[model samples]
Structures are given as structure tokens and as C-alpha cells.
Target: MTTKINRHLTWQRMCACMATCAMAIVVACPIAGFASVQTASADDTANTVSTIIVRDGMLSRYTQLGGAQGILRQPLENEHPTANGGAEQRFQGGTLFWNPSLRGSYLVRDGMLSRYTQLGGPAGRLGLPCADELAVPGGASQVFQGGTLFWNPSLRGAYLVRDGMLSKYAAARYEQGPYGLPVSDEYAWNGGARQDFQYGSMFWNVSDWWKYSSQGPYPNLAGVSNLNVAVSIASQRVYIRDGERVLYTMITSTGINDWTPRGTYRINGRGPSFYNRNEAMGARNWVRFIGNFLFHSVPIDSSGNYIVSEAWKLGQPASHGCIRLTVADSQWFYNAIPDGTLVSIW
Candidate 1:
């Protein structure tokens, strides 16, 4: 009986050892290999075993196991108020879809989201009912419309706003005086105010003694005659038969060479008797016209005659192309001649 009992005890010990060896082999194998075996297990009891064990974070575990590849793990509930409110779902190939309560589902390609319906709501406001762009008026100032600011088809100037009033600068306001009429003191003082005057009526402000033509009523001299008798270089003598008779006749030196031009000229300027020491002589009331050329009196010698000294004469056409006359003759010419009187030369 004792022997039989010992045999039963040894058999029990052997069975226990065999069970421990099987447990050790299972623990020694790699966890990945063991997991694969568990997943591939065909037995209904082994199939219930999960390969991935859930640990601390349940949400993280759910994402790793339950989420589809290339898709959003959770629904997007956070967005700006201006943005369309919805839960955004992501799919493979980076596609996004919006699911809203009021609006139907929409597909988002790239970064833009477009509605699927053409209903009379926010979608209609996009293009059909709303303008492509909006414009705001600048300020309380003037608003320019279809035409130009100062919409005159022909006229041009600034359209200004001053003291809350609209005004224009134009060429029809402060007009110029008529021909032969004196310019007003106001217009002459304030030249800027005359910019809007009549175009042809304006005349330049010349010296006090200067006068413009009246017979021709033009700036240029044409068939006009002198108010008094005048001499020409070509004739070398006063031509008084055409108008007033000569009071006296005197010998005068005319311009030499072609330096003196022949034309109908006006006595534009005059001055009192002055000495030109460079020519070593005294002149009276030297009349200047057509550049530096002048009509003046030259010094005479002791014989009571005009001196034609070599220094006074440049031989290459002397008198600097001016008419040299006696002092008495020059004084008479100056007092008798008017500013705009025509002086003819052949």
C-alpha cells in the first residue's frame, strides 16, 4: 500500500513540473511573436484575447487601434466663429469633408470650402446676389462719378474745394483790358488774378515812356508812318516831304557797312547825353534800337566841323554801325520823336 501511494505522489510531481515548463516557454517567447500567434489563433477561446493592451490613456489607445489610416483621429469641433461651423472629417489622400446640421455635407479641396447647394442663403450671397467687390466713398469731400471732376468737355483746370465750397480755376474770370486801354491797377498788381483773363487782350508791362502802336492795332509795324520827319541811312537825309516839313537840315553821319539793317523800326528807347570815353567823345540822348546800335552825337573838331579821327573811326565801317550826328541835331530828334513812331530804312 505504501509503495502504491509513493508512486502516485511521484506522478503528481511530474505533472506539476510539466505544467511549469510550458508556462516558462510561453514567457520566454517575444511579445510580438506571441501577439501574432494570439491574433492568428483559430480557437474561439484564444480569439477573444486582444493583442494590444489598453494602458493609461483610453483615447490614445482608441486612436491607435480604431482610427483609419490617413484620416482624422477625432472630429474637429474647434474653429473660429466666422468659419463655417461643423465637424470636419478627413479621409485618405488629404481630402476633407464638412458635416453641418443645417447645411448638407460638403467636400473641401485644397484650402477652399465650397457649398454644394444653390439655395437662397449664405450660398446665394457668395456670387449671384452680392457684388464681386465693394467700394466705400472716401470722405465728406466731393465724389467723382462717370465723367471727369470738372466735367467740361473742352475746358481744363483744377476743381478745388475750399471753405466747403466747390470752385474751379478757368480762363474766363479776370479778363485783360482792351487794346490801347490802360491795365487796371488791381490786375497789374496781382498778376496771378489775370491768368484767367482774355487771351489776346493782355499786353506786357513796359517802361513808363514806351508806347505801343495804335493805327495798325497790332504789335508789329506795317504801313505805319512816323509822327514826325525822320532820316534814313540809305537816303542820308531827312525825308520830310511825305509828312511834316523839315524845320532844319544838318549834315549827319550814317552807319557804314551792312551792319545797319534796313527795316521799318520804332524808337524803343532813349537816354540823355552821356560821354563814351572809349570812343573819346561826348554824345547827347543816345537813341538805341535793334541791339547795341545807336543814334548819338559825336565830338567835333576846332574848325566847327565833326571830327572823323582814326580812333573814332574803325575804318571797317565806323561808329559801331550807329548814326553819328551833331549834339544839337540829336537833342532835337530826341524831343520830337515818340516811342512807337516808325523809322524807315532803305
Candidate 2:
């Protein structure tokens, strides 16, 4: 017990000595060194005096943005002339990109900055930022990289638009077109490039997007291939597609006992036709595909009574080899589908 007490006293004396030495060093150090150390502290939010200088419009704009206490914090770099004869100033959390074309410098941050880096900043296609993020119809946007990164505070991120797609979006009055602002970057699709937008997607398979050409339902179809129909026996659902874009989807039932042949076919004809072994007028609404595979309604007896057991088996394979759809869906398919809609099963 005496040894432990002595050891504790010795440790306390050592700690006091260490603290005194630290205080002595601080007292001996020059004031400039201490200021330098404080400037580089971990709290980037610290509002230390910055020696960085700004002038003219840059200074005016910096003050307007609330100087040191504002969102921009402190200026990290000096203002420099851009290739477009404009000026730019980088801040702690955002950047002020200004061109003679604008009233004041626009601030950019968040998803806008990340996308700017990805698009290669000023060195890439989008040259200097002509404007800061400003309000538009649905949300806000900033013009950069010769395009715009649109942001909505309520939405998670911004959408991108530039080049031909931007032209289309503008032509459609900005989000007024079938293809809205691009939610995704351009990617390889169907031997060409494609981008997704808010309202719908656009395809740039090196095709004439501005041609106002009509393919399927789009007066401005932008994809490489027309999205078609697909039926999965396993999941028992139907999908109407335009490339990867699913126009419509519905739950369906397929054949049981290997009766549903798995192959791709088209809508060769429509109904007022017989449904399987039920005979002509056997199905009130139906369509035929493959040799015998059909998209038909729930079974109706000769007196038009709903077959209860067959109705209960709607999502399961109950038909001989036919695909079953609800009555309204079957009726719509029979009445609406043109003669040559594509159909595939597996």
C-alpha cells in the first residue's frame, strides 16, 4: 500500500511537470506562430482573420454573401479571370462563378459541385459557369459546363441537362417536354448513348432527336429501340416497354403444367374469338399469340356466369396454355392494341 501511494504521487508530479513545460513553450513562442497554428485549427468553421484579398465585384459580392459568418465562410483563393473574360472565387463551402452576362456571382455547392467535378469542371465541355444556381419553374438550377444542374430542395439531388438534350428540354419550355432534365449521366445504351430525365427518358443513338420523328407513341422518341411487351410466367406479370422504359405493367396469370410455351411472338390478331377449348364467342374479350397462347379473361360459363374456381386462380397458372388478364384489361387489349404489337413469354 505504501509503494502504490508513492507511485501515484510520483505520477502526479510528472503530469504537473509536463503541463508546466507546455506552458513555458507557449510563453516562449512568438505570437505569429500561435496565430498560424490557430488559423489551421480543425474547426474549419472558426472565423479567424484571413489574409486573402478580394477587390471590385468580388469584394462587393463577398460582403453581400455575409462575409466571414455566411455560408461561404472564407475565401480559399483569390479571384481569377476565366477564359470567357469572367471572374471566379472559391469559398470554403461553395464557389462564386461570375461572368459579365450575369447580375452578380452565383453560389454553387452540394450535388451541383459534385456534378461539376464529374463533368470535368471548367476544363471540360462546360467552359466557365455563366451563372450561379438560380430559381426556375419547378426548383432551382445553375449553368455550368455549357449545361445546367437543376436542383429542387425537396428532391434528393439535381438533374443535368446540356447539348442536344438541353436543347430539347428548352424547346419543350423546360420540363414541359416528354424528356425532362436528365436525372442520370449519359451512358452506353443500345449501341448508342442515353440519359434519363424526370418526365421520361431520351435516347441519343446518334439519331436525329430534333427531327421530330415519330416512333411508336413518341412524336419525339429518343431511344435506340421501341420498348415492347414482355410476359414472365414465373412472376405472372405483363410489362409494356420502350427500351428499358416500362410504359405500363400489370399482374397476370400464365399456363400451368408446361402448357405455356416460352417464346417471343407478336399480336397477330385480336378477339371476339374462342378462348382455348371454350369455343368461338367462348371468350367475351381476348387476344391470341403464338400458335395457341392467348391473353384472355376469366372463364365465363355458357350462360356468362363467372367460373368461381378459375377466378380464384387469377395469379396462378390455371389455363391450358393461355395467359389470363382481368376483364377490363382483356377488353382494353382487344380493343386498343394494333395488329402488330410484340409479345414475348418465358
Candidate 3:
């Protein structure tokens, strides 16, 4: 478990990529640069106090690998100092970084750089670009010793997915689910990493899609899910719909042995509430669809035990005048449907 305070504190830690230094350069050094250097060949912009100096070997490599023929085009700035005694240079396509202990330079560009800069660049937790940005299906990404940055046009912006949080994002199909793309960097939360997405906030330790709100931690199911409902007395089935689109059809148990009034009904309020002749604690998420009859989990006996086995009774006619649903189905019914929505029973 994580402490409540840990979820709120910010740390100055970076990743393994910046543990060393490389080629020299100039910029308002706030973060460590990522790369290595062999020799120097100054550009025309060199000898200027503001532009810093560029190396000939490094420039040659860049020209051949990432210059005119490459996506980066031309150099934007000369080499400069980065955090942790590192050197760096800016190119149209991206930024180049070098550390003293390494033998070569690494380039950072595209969406990866965008996310890094958002994370405070080298000055923040992700010290430097450890690897070149790589292409993937539908988008691009770069791996830092500290974490991974992901960019997909559909997500609208670059975002970080690192640590155990990566597994959580993958579980939700990484930007495909209702959670959408991450909008905020991972922070301490509930003793684990937390990230906010387009649809919801993900807590690595607490849950994949939950946020602390005034009402307490809740799922942000705002953009998805809907509230249309229907029940068939003859087939003993419940149908939940999103407008005219069916969200799900579930087998249910209707008052097989008793009078289950049929007609249109408005769910008045939470069930498990006493009205007419029925009341029980075991019955949960109750919604009254007809007189005294409710759409609720299997009715519990006087002793407070569910009298019907959910697996066995489903898809069959059962229940004591009430519509019987499984625990999960009942919860979904209550949570997804608004109180005043129409519940048609036929």
C-alpha cells in the first residue's frame, strides 16, 4: 500500500540515461543532455556566446543520418550545456544529447520530445532522451531509462507511460479504452503511480481508471456507458440500451410464481427500500419497475441469504413477484440508469 502523502509529493528523480555526460553545447541548461561525443568541427554559428559550439564529427554524423536527407533537416542551435555536465544541440526534427561516459550521440524528436519537454525536459524526472524515437503502429514512442513516452494523433498530445503504470495502460489497450490518452504525468498517488487521461484518472496501485473526487474515488464513466432499460416478462430477460442501441441483453428471473405487474414504470428511487410487502438486505441495487416488484439481485430469505443460485436460476422464470438479476447485473442496472428514466416491462 502507498501512503496518502506519497500520492501528493513531487520528486526530483530522473532515469538511468543521464548518469553520465557527452558532447558539449549551450542552452539555458536545466536538464542533462543525452548522447556521446568523439571530436569537434565548429559550425559557422560557433564562436558566438549564445549559440555555443558544434563538433565536426558529430555534425557529420547528424548531416548523414538526420540532416537534409533525414527528417530533421538542418541544425537549429549549436551545442550547449545540459544538466548533469551533459551537452546537447537542437535540430529541426528533434534534439541531440550526449553524455561524457558514452561514445556517441542520441537524437530525440517528434512526439517523444514533446512529452519530454512537458515532463520538464532533462531538468525533470526524465533526465535525457536515452534512445531515438521509434515508430509503432498508428504512432511513435521513445524509451527513456526513466520511462516511455507515447504519441498518437488520436490522443491529441504526447504523454508518458512508464513504470508499473505501463502495464495498466496496456491492459486498457493503451489509449483505445474509455480512459483515452494520458493528459498528466505519473505522480505519487495512493502509494503508486497515478496518471490522468482524457476520460479518467488512472491509479497504478488503486485502480486503472479512478480519481479522487469530492464524492471520493470514483470511476469517470462520463463519456461512455448509457441509461436505457427494458424488461420482458415472458422471456424473463433484461435489456439495457444506449438510446436505441442495445448495450447488453441479460437473462433474468421474473415473478414466475407470483403476480409481476406489467406496464410502463418509472424507477422512483433506490430499492432495498420498504414498500408494500417486500424488503431484504441481500437484495441490492433495487429499482422498482412495477408495484412493489423491483429489478434487484436475487431475493434473500428472512435469514438474509440469497434464496436462488444466480448461475442456475438465470434464463428461467423465477422470483417472488420481483425481477431477479445477478449481483453484477443488478449493480449495472442501478448505476447506469437514472432515477427518472423509463423502465418498460412487458
Best by lDDT: 2
lDDT of 1 by residue, 1-346 (tens): 1121111222223222221231121111121212212222233233122122211222232244343332333222222122234333332222232224333332332212222121112222221111111121221111111111211112322121111111221121211111111112113312222211111122223221011111112122233353543655543443322255433333345666656666767777888755555755555567875566667665443343445462233112345467655455566556655565566656
| TM-score: model 2 vs. ground truth | 0.45
What CA RMSD would you report for each candidate?
36.5, 18.0, 15.9
Off by over 4 Å in 2: 1-50, 81-83, 100-104, 136-139, 152-155, 176-181, 190-192, 205-346
Q: Which ten residues in a row are the worst by lDDT in model 3?
A: 8-17
Candidate 3 displacement at residue 156 in angstroms = 2.5
> Across residues 184-256, which tens digit of lDDT does each residue of candidate 3 receive?
6777876766677544455666531211321113333366455556777765656665666544555577766
Better model by lDDT: candidate 2 vs candidate 3: 2
CA lDDT scores, all candidates in order: 0.34, 0.60, 0.59
lDDT of 3: 0.59
- Per-residue accuracy of model 2 over 1-346 as CA lDDT, tens digit each: 1121111222223222211221121111111222212233344432233344555676667668886568886557777776666677787778777767664676777778876767666666676676767777667778764887887455657766778767756765675433434556666655665666554345565442211111123222234267467887775666667766766554466877968888878887666646334442245567878666678776777666656556556546777788876565666566665557777787
Candidate 2, residue 5: lDDT: 16
Misplaced by over 4 Å in model 1 are: 1-230, 240-249, 275-282, 300-318
Q: How far is candidate 3 from the true structure (C-alpha RMSD, Å)?
A: 15.9
lDDT for 184 (candidate 1): 21
lDDT of candidate model 1 versus the reference: 0.34
Model 1's TM-score against the true structure: 0.28
Error of 1 at 183 (Å): 50
